[model samples]
Target: MISTVLQAVGLFVATNIDDIIVISLFFARGAGQRHLTAKITAGQYFGFAGILAVAVLIALGAGAFLPVEAIPYFGLVPLVLGLRAAWSSWREYRDNDGDDDSDGDSATGKGSGNAVGVLGVAGVTFANGGDNIGVYVPVFVNISHTAIAAYCVVFLILVGALVYIARFVATRRSIAEILEQWESVLFPLVLITLGVVILVSGGAFGL
Candidate 1:
């Protein structure tokens, strides 16, 4: 029980770090407002729930028809996604002239840009969720279906809470100023770390 709890806790943190960072960026862009944040959160929760449900279904259906050995390779999904996230993060830090504007906001722009448009929000969420799916593929082998569902529920709740907190912080004059001051350095470092961690775990670097 203890080991399982520890594993779950570790997985949760590892899988969600990049997502938290990206979401915080949007919040920094003023997507942090209560209404838009809630909308984005809702879209993410629904998307996550849908994806997790599909994964569950695949696991169960395939259990009756295929060999279990193929399961671990399912980690590859996150491996690819992690690489993409890393690249995106690196670009955010390196390019400097591509995406972000004068205010250090993503080129998509602030206010309207960070509004969490369906496409943008979904894309970001999907990319960030790579690690979560990878972790789930392996963990699902040991845990029950009910446990998986419960974990998904808990994850969504936590994500929503984090979005709320980040939005609030982004709205603060002092916090927003601080975030703007170190945009380039902080985003790259955080994303690079997250990318490496996810890739290593997903067996992408041959590690």
Candidate 2:
């Protein structure tokens, strides 16, 4: 039991450590908006729940549900999201030229950009997690249902912890300033790059 618990912790952290930067970037754009923070958190949970569901299904003999090679197609989710974000950023600049009170959709002139709200966050989270699906399927194999439940519980708890830690980093004054300044550029670029990498690295490109 202890071993299972430890393994769950180790596996989850190892697989999900990279999410810190993404989650932090999301929080950085919150700009003290508590509602936005709640949205981000809920979106994250929603996205991860989808991932877990897929993994569990595939592990439980639902192989036909999604062929292994098709996982790369998930990259499309983030790729499109990135493109959408980029478009919003560009439009914001073109229309308002960074004016804070120009009556743009975001009065702040520095909101996280359009299309990057709850569903957008959730979509990208699900998209960027292609690898987690690959790792989780095999890990769930042959394990007792009890251990699986333990793993899931531990994983969800740690996900909340991950969000809190990233939020702390994002809320730091210095980091927040930089993120706010470049969020328009950085967020889309990061998302696009992540998508391309996932597609290419999966060893089978295209739908």
Candidate 3:
């Protein structure tokens, strides 16, 4: 039981380290907009739950019909997403001529008075979590359903805690400033690195 609990903690942290940055940005958006914090939190959890559901399904499938080794190929989803993010950032920078306001506008979706919609945030979370499926499938396949259930419980609890942490960091002026400044560049890089890590760890590269 203790081991399963520890495993759950480790998996959550490993899969979600980048989420800290994403969550912080959402909370920062909330700070700028009116009463968006709760929405962002709900969206984030909704998105995370989606990722978990997909991973669990894939894991279950892997036990029967799917080949375990093929799991690493899923990393390509995040790799492409990361590359697209980078390309978009480059295009935005070039188009805006490096204007800070433009960056703010893009990050915060300025046209909208309210925070991002629940589905919008969920989409971001799901895209960002593409690599998570690769990591989670094996972990889930190796364990019993009972352990998986425990992990789910722990993950659901931690998702809320993570939002609180992100909100706390977002409320801080300096940290929020830094996130806004670098998130466009940093987010893609994190996704790219995660994809590479998944591929390498899973031996998908045949290395």
Candidate 4:
């Protein structure tokens, strides 16, 4: 049970780290946008719940067909996602001559005022969480349904905590700047590391 809780925490952190950036951006719009914060939080939860539902169904279906030992190979999903993210970041950096500002502007522009509504935020959260499905499916496949339910409970609580943390960070210019500056590099690295952890822990390579 302790291990399961720890695993849940780790999974939550790895999968949602990028969300902090997005949430912070939303909160950074100043006091006038305070009301939208609740909407964004609700959207994040709703979108994440949708992603989990899909992953759970897929995991159950795959579990019924795939051998237990082969489950870990699903780790390849996140591995590939990480590699693609790295490639995309590299391309963006090269294209912009290392000016990260352009990338930031592009991201902010896409999600700006356009995402003030609950559904809009939900859509953004779901879109950003595409890679989350890859990471979650294998984890869910290996765990019992009860365990999955517990994890979901933990995740819901953590989601609220994450929103609060993001709100706090939005007011901290230095930390927000640092996170924004390093997020591209950090996010891919975290995903890659998570994939390796899943593979090893799942005994994919018999390690």
What C-alpha lDDT values do all the predictions have? 0.55, 0.79, 0.71, 0.68
Q: What TM-score number comes out for model 4? A: 0.58
lDDT of 1 by residue, 100-178 (tens): 4445345433323224454445544554455455457666767887677666666666666666766676667887787
lDDT of 3 by residue, 1-207 (tens): 999998899989988876877677656444566557777777778888977887898888834444456656656655766686677767666776746566566545333432345765666676556577767878998999999999999998998888888788877888878766666666568667766776677778794
Please give the lDDT score at residue 207 for candidate 1.
62
Tens-digit lDDT track for model 4 on 10-82?
Answer: 9999989877866775554323444777887887888788767767777878445444455566566556555
Off-target runs (Cα >4 Å) in candidate 3 are: 62-110, 179-207
Q: What count of clashes does model 4 give?
A: 0
Q: Lowest summed lDDT over 10 consecutive residues: which window, candidate 1? A: 107-116
Question: Any residue pairs clashing in model 3, and if so which?
Answer: none
Top-TM-score structure, candidate number: 2
Off by over 4 Å in 1: 1-10, 31-34, 61-114, 180-207
Q: Give Cα distance to truth, residue 190, candidate 4, Å.
A: 18
Q: Indicate whether candidate 1 or candidate 2 has the larger TM-score.
A: 2
Ranking by lDDT: 2, 3, 4, 1
* Stretch of 10 with least lDDT, candidate 4: 106-115
lDDT of 2 by residue, 92-173 (tens): 7887765766863465545445433778778878877789988998889879778778888888888788888888888889
TM-score of each: 0.56, 0.89, 0.65, 0.58
Which pairs clash inside model 1? Answer: 99-107
